[model samples]
Target: MSSDLFDDVFTLEDRFYTEGYNQGVQDGARAGRIEGRSFGMEKGFEKFLESGRIASKSLVWANRLPKNPQPGGASDEKCSEACTLPPLPKNPRLEKNIKLAYALVEPDTLSTENSDEAVQDFDDRVKRAQGKVKIIEKMLS
Candidate 1:
């Protein structure tokens, strides 16, 4: 009777152990995916920042030209003046929207406590940027 009691007491249940291990694995995978997605978004935001700077510069240069550029009708001197400025590959509104998006991505003035609001603001800025991109596309075509 003592041997039987000892055997039963010392026996381990593999099922519970396996369940715990599997749960841990699932939890780890979920954590890893969340971290990976956040990292990827940060890297992408950095790239967008660089592009935004370039587009902003281009828009500033284009602003040197007359609001209405008559390419064929403008005089030689006027054309020369316009030619000195950088060509506008995209709409100025698009560049402005991109700048706004860049600012929203990581604003230095925003506090950690307002992170949720900042995220909502960022989403709105991104939507505006997307709309501006569509407008630029239409203008180009």
Candidate 2:
């Protein structure tokens, strides 16, 4: 009877150890994937800079790559934004050009540079924020 009890305990221990090993394997796999993705993104960004679609001097601006360059992104808002992997190459002639190009990647920061149609549509929003366009939004009947 004691021998049978010992065998059962041993089997339970083995099962526990197997579960722990499997969990470790899963965690390791997930970590490896995250690391691999980060490495790949860095390499791809570097390769893109080298492709000459962007001028050598443009590297100065490109180097200022935002970590989270998505539309309407605040600082470090990468997860909230979706930056295209391959950005367009353009020859902008001014500092504003650099800023605008950066906006092309991350547009949320460029609230002022929203499309002309969008700007026209939001005139009322600005008035509302400034407390200028307050109609009787509701009537307490």
Per-prediction TM-score: 0.44, 0.33
Off by over 4 Å in 1: 3-11, 14-114
Candidate 1 C-alpha lDDT tens digits along 55-136: 4643554454334545887655755565666545645665554445444433453233336685565446555655655555
Report the poorest 10 consecutive residues by lDDT, candidate 1: 105-114
Count of clashes in candidate 1: 0
- Highest-scoring model, lDDT: 1
The TM-score of candidate 1 is: 0.44
- Cα RMSD for predicted model 1: 7.4
Where in model 2 is the C-alpha error above 4 Å? 53-141
